[model samples]
Target: MKITFLTVGKTEDAYLKEGIEKYVKRLKHYTKLELVELNELKNTKALTPEQQKAKEAEMILKKITPLDHVVLMDEKGTEYSSTRFAAYINKREISSSATLIFIIGGPYGFDSSVYQRANDKISLSRMTFSHQMVRLFFVEQLYRAYTIMKGEPYHHE
Candidate 1:
């Protein structure tokens, strides 16, 4: 199975970009992983929150294929312990040959259509983090999840 991390816009902070790249490189030891960035909407000051999300959703949906199991990193979504998350990924890996697409939406979050298309939603924490920060956090957790699954020492219970 392929694991793809799709996020909106660029990670402009050099520090954050470094951290995200580190995890992305580490993850390659486990599975087929890819990171995709969707361009940020231009002149968003003119658009309403709803309009911004709609435009973002159009780009997001266009990248997803029917064979993908879309998962969104959402604040209101279910939170999981590291072990449980590892198990969840294991289950999905065994169950489907589809691509596992995980998305980190923009500042305003996702559109209703994005929600509708998602196969599942997961929350990294109850507190909010900047959308850019979430990309690093998510990739780290994904690496941790693999370690947990393989009985590796990378993650501690």
Candidate 2:
């Protein structure tokens, strides 16, 4: 199965970009992975938080196809251990041929429309992290999950 890591805005920090790129390269050995960075909205001085989210939702929804399995990286979503997350990825790999899209919404979180389109929701942690930081963390965790799936030495209990 192909995996898509979709996020809003560019990751500006050099360190974060380097970290994300490292895992993305490693992930290529296991599965096809796509890293899509949507353009952030311009000139948002007038828009309220809700409005900004609504605009972001529109951009996000456009990237998804009907057959894609969309999962939102949300704070309120199910929390899983690394092993469990590995199992989850393995399950999806075994069960589906569709592209698995994992989305990290904009600052105010996902709008109702985006939420409605999601097939699942996963929480990286209860504590919040910066959106840019979440990109690197998610990719690293994904690499870890694959290693766990392969019974590699990269992950430990």
Error of 1 at 119 (Å): 0.6
Residues 56-93, model 2: lDDT tens digits? 99999999999999999999999999999999999999
Model 2 bad stretches (over 4 Å): none
Q: How close is each model in CA RMSD to the real structure?
A: 0.8, 0.7
Scored against the true structure, residue 46 in model 2 reaches a CA lDDT of: 93
User: In model 1, which range of ten residues has the least summed lDDT?
Assistant: 89-98
Task: Please give the CA lDDT of all the candidate structures.
Answer: 0.93, 0.95
Give the candidate number with the greatest lDDT: 2
Report how far residue 47 has shifted in candidate 1, in Å.
0.5
CA displacement after TM-score superposition, residue 11 of candidate 1 (Å): 0.8
